[model samples]
Target: MKKLTYLFIALFSLSLLTTSCREEKTASEKVEEAIEDTGDAIEDAADDVEDEVEDITDDNK
Candidate 1:
């Protein structure tokens, strides 16, 4: 019974150590999300600029 208990404990500890590495969402994910947000913002700014240009052209005509 004691040998089986020791074996179980060792296996459990090994399992815990194996599962501890490779955690979720470090800096790369945040940077990627920030980049995606920046792209969307730039696209929105471009659309606004295009609308303004069209408005100015219509006014001129």
Candidate 2:
């Protein structure tokens, strides 16, 4: 029973330590991520436009 209590305490402490050690993004990191996301969105939009144009052209042909 004592060993089981110690084991539970150790696991709880380890969980606390892991949860508290999370990495936070800096302002510049956030800006960079936003820029990348915007770029990806733009690229996806462009691809979708291109696909629509091709479909329209194919239907016309």
Candidate 3:
């Protein structure tokens, strides 16, 4: 029974240690995220410009 108690405590401690650790992003991951953000911004800007052009053409017609 004592050994069983110690085994339970050890497993609980191991689980706590593993769960508390965080994984950090690598440099390539950071670069990829930045590139994705920039692409999304550019795409949004293009959509806005396209909408403005459509509005202008509709008003002229």
lDDT of 1 by residue, 1-61 (tens): 9999999999999999888566678899989999999999999999999999999999999
lDDT of 3 by residue, 1-61 (tens): 9999999999999998888657899999999999999999999999999999999999999
Candidate 3 collision pairs: none
* Ranked candidates, highest lDDT first: 3, 2, 1
Best TM-score goes to which candidate?
A: 2
TM-score of each: 0.59, 0.71, 0.65
- Runs of candidate 2 exceeding 4 Å displacement: 1-20
Better of 1 and 3 by lDDT: 3
Return the lDDT, model 3, position 43. Answer: 100
Task: Show where candidate 3 strays beyond 4 Å.
Answer: 1-20
Q: Could you tell me which 10 consecutive residues in candidate 2 have the lowest summed lDDT? A: 13-22
Clashes of 2: 0
Candidate 2: pairs in clash = none
Comparing 1 and 2 on lDDT, the stronger one: 2
TM-score winner between candidates 1 and 3: 3
Look at candidate 3 and tell me the lDDT of residue 36.
Answer: 100
